[model samples]
Target: MLLLLPTLIGLVVAASIPPSIPHETLEVIPDGWKLHSTAEDSQTIALQISILHHHTDYLDIAHDVSNPESANYGNYLGAEELEASLPEYQRSAAEVVSWLNNHAISKTTLDGDWLHFETTVGQAKELLGADFMYYQHGSDDPVLRTRKYDIPIHLRDAIDFIYPTTHFMRPKWPAKMHLLPRQHIPTGPVTCATSICPKNLTAKYNITHVPADSNSGSQLGIGGFLEQYPDHKVVQQFLKDYGLRHHDKPYKYKVTLINGGKDPNIPAKSGAEALLDVEYGMAIADSLPVTYFSTGGRPARTPSQPGNKVVPRNESGNEPWIAFLQHILKMKSPPQVLSLSYTDDELDVPLPYARKVCSLCAQLAARGVSVIVASGDGGSAGTTTKDCKGPNGKLRFIPTFPASCPWVTTVGATNDYGVAHYSSGGFSNYFARPKWQDKAVSGYRTLLNGSHMAWYNKTGRAYPDVALAGSGYLTAGGGATYQQKGTSASTPVFAAMVALLNDKRLRAGKPVLGFLNPLLYKNEGMFRDVTEGDTDGCEVGSEVEVGFGASKGWDAASGLGEPDFAKLLKVLT
Candidate 1:
């Protein structure tokens, strides 16, 4: 699922940059705080973390998760696609650290107390030499059955620590236009998207709606799909069942469990995963001071958006959403963070909408709103879709759209180690790296018992303007707890961080992070550089395709390791 929406706005003069990190700021982790960790064998490693900015007051922790029922479920689709061949044998993630102490791939020293992995066989064994395990991707599930890699012993030998990246910040949800739930959608947030006439660039566009769904969102008939298809694996396992659901938004989703039916082949109804993205991305949107927008998801059934925001193309060439944006911009101030998580990856990247979408985002960024877009999930990023179908008859080299649109702050996915494997990061046949790629803002995975490599020193070029964790482990969704993985999980986590930073900047009275590219590019050490592992969609076994990974300065794969958001605030503030 991708995020897509439209808009514009006007506002007061950009706020002034805040004063030199308030007295309290400079006083805490004075200037550069040097920290070090030691390996079991007694080797000391240095880690430089500049205490850029720290704020615990309004730590707007907005990321995604949960249904209206679950506790603190924001928008992380909880269900993870398990490494179907995960190494059953378990080992303390700490043991894996001991092995890395002897043989390490990255500059970051390993500490068993934190988290670590030890590869026991295959490529990792061959590369790092026995005792480590490699994690592979979901689609690569079939390869594990073979002795392709000795993954179990290494998995058992490792002890790992993973902190939940997102949590409900609080009950305060943010949005430009509030919405009155129509039928299926719960009543809470609102979108003033009336079927009024278009007013902006959208004024030139036109679309139609299914007659049965004249009010696709206002009526229950159109929303019945939610109830009827709870059994559908994609929905049950990923959307309704996944992530941390808050108590307020529970009705937004009904966790009724479904069956594949007595017959294993029974098919269900029409549906999509845009909401999962909305919830996740929404958290990010809320976190930031910027206004979030999307084209609703996919090519929203004609005029309705994925989030069901209505589009009145006939009206001023813009829909209510766009108009609302303009109205907000006309106010005393406009939002600084704008996010669109929808994409038409199956559609052409240069389509009229793609151009419009990217152009709009570019317009916002120019005005100071840092636009964030998901690089994409479909491996090819829309370079190969349409006629390109796989053995399963599904689009084979299908590309994710919009992310290919260079104007927005595009982000790709990465694993815990900052590797660009999974279906996340990659170059777009349709777009080029934007200036942002060189700057701040932007944003893979494992397996080998069905385990494997993510980002390794320039092993591949698929990026993530930055990186965050998007691999396996655990989550809760549908009606039960399960596991899942994908770039889908990474986007929101990044959004939340953006939100936290935005809050800090706003409180300090800074020009809301406009075009973050320049600032991010100006600073380097603020981030912990990622420098290992290789993304496999492009090919790995072939020695000819090596040297792709993260490294000193900027390399693809993992743009920059997970951000030290607080430190980043100090630099920017």
Candidate 2:
């Protein structure tokens, strides 16, 4: 049983500070956008102020807890302990709250490093020292944002950034498409079918067995965004179809609804993405308990009103991912392994927001959770046309986040044990490469030998860390079975494998593999290195094309390659 930490009382201090100074301009309003003078200043807007933390302290804790060589390995921190270790936030929070109180905005809530408060546009502009305006994107509704903002010099140390201020992070859906004419599901049991199935894939990868008793303590979490709901009925059918369910047994799993998350019963509206995630995870790790987290809030825009304008469906709370992270952090114990299939181009999200989300992943790692994210299905360049365009107006290879985040393990897609053409891979423009992957990435760079090198950031973090079968899988959704494909399929498959590994470790009286990169990089030989195929996409007419090819070692197309589960288990044990 995990022990919960008592909340510590924060001390509020009042200080006389100088007037605000001209701070850095975070984002510039796009060209040809005119401000709406009639836009309501009284419109209520909820803001999430992200506070800075002691970077070294958290990084040290993450390393010490994850590295097997360290004496502190497996000694994970509780939520309270993590909070206490970063004392910078406490002082910073008090100062910011005091400042807020003085501005007649005394009603504010603080959760870890996030300070939440509701303020009008007029008051927000006054507090942040900026002008708020409406900017139109395509035919979408005018989004309210500030071109630039200033924070008081004294309070700068306390706050890193604010969300919904200048950042626009759109959530991406799983990459699933119907099989081509040549592709078809086999007539026999899914396990014996030629197409990739849980049973066949597991057997081939040497992950055929998991201890039954270990299921009681092991849990796997699947994150759902954009209102995708995982129905229980569809999951049961999927399990039965794959021979994973007992004849008379009913489907069983936990459902956590965060911020109005829903599990729609209707087949037409029941999300195929959610169904694929839950079914694959439960089918792969049959014994382990699965928790489907249906997180709420509109991660993307929806068509609304007159003239087909696009607008956010939920504007009441933080972004879906942020809210989901906060909810998990507040728990006494979060799932050891979490699989997220949603992602967006790294360039679409502002630097500060990306860093904040990545920092939260680091925090999750310190507490023993292994975050597995899809590397995306946009090939070498990201899915967006505008986002892929470089500063020089040339099409460049773009990466996705939080796959590009160094803390989380990213899984790419493969078809029949080879790299899939649409599997997204590349280096990040915002984040630098972490020390753990330096040698492998450096080797890849040497292999490239300056070929297409100018299209990406050489020092940026490279992905993905692993690959798995991502195409020609049968999935049940909307009351019917269909073939699906994408790195979305690979992520859950890899996560379930990790969950099984954790179960084995626990049964053997060992700690779960927390923050997989350290162990993964150290034991690269444990995996089946994929050396063929390439990711192809991001075409800009006849002049430019973007993609990366598989190589002998770790390459952008397929990381260290598919996991050889039996080998991985033997090595870890």
Candidate-wise lDDT, in order: 0.33, 0.77
Q: Candidate 2 residues 1-573, lDDT tens each?
A: 123222221212223444676654643443224454333677666777887765558778998899878999888888888776664677889888988887789888887778988787799888888676655555444555676777887887778887776765557775676743442333336434646667777777887564444344667999988878777766676676674546455656688999777776566766778878888888777768888888877522223223533444345435888888878876787898999999887876778888888888988888889999999988987765523575345567878888999999999988874799889898998889988899999999999888886678899999999998888877766544577899998899889888888888888788888899988988999988898888875566665464888898899999999899888888876
Write one digit per residue (lDDT tens) for candidate 1, span 17-120: 11111011011111111212111222121111111112211111111111123243222111121111122322343344343444453433222122322222
**Which candidate wins on TM-score?**
2
TM-score computed on alpha carbons, candidate 1: 0.41
The parts of candidate 1 lying over 4 Å away from their true place are 1-334, 344-347, 351-353, 380-400, 426-463, 473-477, 538-548
